[model samples]
Target: MLLRLPTSVSEAQQCLSEGAIPVGGATLQWAVWQRDGFPEQAMSLREVPEANVLSAEALGAAVPLHRVDDRVPEVLRRAAGGIGTGAVRRSATVGGNIVGSTLRCLLPAAVVLDARAVVLDVEGPFETDLAELTAKRPLLLSLRWRTPQASGYRKLAEAPGGPPPLVVATAVHAPEGARPRLRIAVRDGYEVLAESVECDTGVASVLDALAGTAIGALPAEAREVVREQVTELLARTAA
Candidate 1:
């Protein structure tokens, strides 16, 4: 069990280039550690200045879930609030939650917000769409977005107020009379996004059109359940 906590970004980069796996809060990393034992080397961004910095334009990779409080936009704040408890939030990071995640709460929220993540490696930083980064599992540095006007999220868990087996999120950018370009992500394990569809803003009509269009895989019953949940989600954002 070897660990290196780098106090600076350059040091962290050096450690990563030397083959150390990055650990933020070590939530998932610990899961891996318990199953497979610690890797030969691991690095922590705990001391880096940008690791947990949060502002209007961007959130640092290591920003803990708890810090993303109500100051965040509703779509993100609402989703972040659902993640475990205060203790888990203290450790789980925005970056850690998105990258290599099986059932992430952030991906759909970020994608619907049109967020971009800055990934760091030996070469340098590169930008990637937040949704795509979930599968790519890059070494994330930060996530940025301009913000969306209308966005919402909902989940229908297997149990009452439990972890959801299905999650849905929607966002729209519309000005004046222009048809809104709706972005949607429906999650089973990973999220599946719809190409921004231009359509009327009538909630029922839009939901009807999108229910069949965005989500590709689902049994008849599950789809109906999603439709009901999405309707409720839109209601919140609209209000």
Candidate 2:
């Protein structure tokens, strides 16, 4: 396989236009490689300067999970730290975590934070909401979001070191005078179950309202677990 390492976004775009598959971190690509073999051509975004930017409001796609520091939202930092082992965290890129076929901790955090993704495809660069970005599977350039008033994250795995079956992220937004708006996102290993913003409803009522929406697809036992965990997370963040 031919691998193209581009130092600039334009160079990377050219490689992409030539049909090179964009690779960030290549952690997820390991599974793809094992299943489908390597692509004929691959472009590494790690060397692209624009894909390395990091700050309070923006994180480049190639930025490693371990590099997600306190400068970003607390929920994001916590989610990044909890992804995997130290080595895995050091190697996994934010973009890969967000767009990978398997849901990762960062996705729920990004959802609650309302992050927007910048993507580069063969046509050129474009920006889209993170909620809508993953399905296209484009080359993510970076993610940007405004800081929230407060945020929290939680995850529940079946085994000691197994992949989490459920993960939840919550953000509290207090508009002047009105009740605090609570944004919640839940994910089970493969897809998002629910993402919505609620106001004024107590935890029980909110869970009831979500009975047929976010947790509807889950089995009865799994739905109870989600409710319990989501209630705990919401209580903590809402406190």
Candidate 3:
């Protein structure tokens, strides 16, 4: 078992280039460590200043979920705060949420945020638009984006209240006219099923649009309930 804790981004990048798996806040890594003990090569990012920084210069990927400022962009803050529980929030980093699983909410939120995710390899920094990473899994170094006017997010789980199957995230910025520009991303369980940029003038319109995109993936009985909840959620946020 071996652990390399890097104090700076370059040190972390150097370790990663040497094939160490990146680990920040170990929430997702614990299960793997339990089964595999220590990985053949591992890097712990807890002490890395780059991994904990959150600001206009750094993206959410390096930020700890609980430490994000609530003022930067409301949607991102809400998304980060929703990762798991209090304990998980303390340990989980945004990069983990981005690449962790098929059931994560951050990527969809990233779409609405129009975020850019970066990866620093030994070759230097390689960047990709956030939307590009939704389908393909990419290890991230930092995530950056411009803050919008207002944004909202909703996660709906099955009866037990465990991992959610459906997540609806929206971002709004005032356009040239009366209606605000809307960007939305919808995830049903394992994959992001759909995303749209449109002007949804009313709640019914938004419900219809999301339902049309995600209805087939959800159970028949649950569709109406989803619609109801999504409607209320959008309306509440809009107001």
Candidate 4:
């Protein structure tokens, strides 16, 4: 494999234009390489200054999961901190978590938080929703989102040290004199589903409304688990 390490965003983009695959942390890419062999050309973003930004409202693509500190939202911090073992968290990048799989812990949180990704393609830098960015498989530069009024996250694993079967994230925003708006994202070990609902009556009403929307895509048993966890999350964050 021909590996290129660039120090700036422009240099990285130039390498990308030359058909180099962007790699962050390489934790996920390492697994892929182990299974399918390394790509012909690749660029590591670790040395790119722009890919290391971590602030109150933005995170660079190469920011390690372990560095997701108190500056970001509570739900994001929890998701990042809970991703894997301490060593894995130290080695995994936020960009890798988002691009690697929809089942990744940070993705559902990104969905509910309305995070936008800054991406660089053949056309150059542009911004889009995280979900859309993931679909295009572009080189992610950074992620930005406004802090919500309240947020919560939950994960369900089959056993200790086992992969989580379900991951849920919720964001609540209350407009003056208007009903609170609740947004949710659920990953049912297969797909990430998201929806927004107005909390008109209570958490139960919100649960019932989601029964036919985002939560509906889950199997019956998974649906029940979602209902229970979402109920608890809403009660706390939306209160």
- Cα lDDT, all candidates: 0.72, 0.79, 0.68, 0.81
Give a tens-digit lDDT track for model 3, residues 114-218.
Answer: 778776556665788766665565557777777666677766645575646567677765646656656666666666654553545676676566656655356
Model 1 C-alpha lDDT per residue in residues 134-157, reported as the tens digit of each score: 666878888888766677777665
TM-score of each: 0.82, 0.82, 0.77, 0.86
lDDT of 2 at 54: 87
lDDT of 2 by residue, 1-239 (tens): 89899998889889988999877788878787879888899888888877998888888989999999999888788889888789998999998888864666688888877788899987888999875787777889998998877777767755766756677677766667767666777776667764564646788777776775756567776677667766776677667
Q: Per model, how many backbone clashes are there?
A: 1, 0, 1, 0
Clashes by residue pair, model 4? none
Error of 3 at 69 (Å): 3.4
Ordered list by lDDT, greatest first = 4, 2, 1, 3
Q: Is candidate 1 or candidate 2 better by lDDT?
A: 2
Off by over 4 Å in 2: 34-36, 160-164, 175-179, 200-213, 216-239
* All models, RMSD in angstroms: 3.2, 3.1, 3.6, 2.7
Model 4, 103-172: lDDT tens digits are 5678888888888998887667788887687777778888888787788877776576655667778887
Answer with 2 or 3, whichever has the higher TM-score: 2
**Candidate whose lDDT is highest:** 4
Question: Residue 191's C-alpha lDDT in candidate 1?
Answer: 41
Local error of candidate 1 at residue 47 (angstroms): 2.2
Instruction: Point out the higher-scoring one by lDDT: 3 or 4.
Output: 4
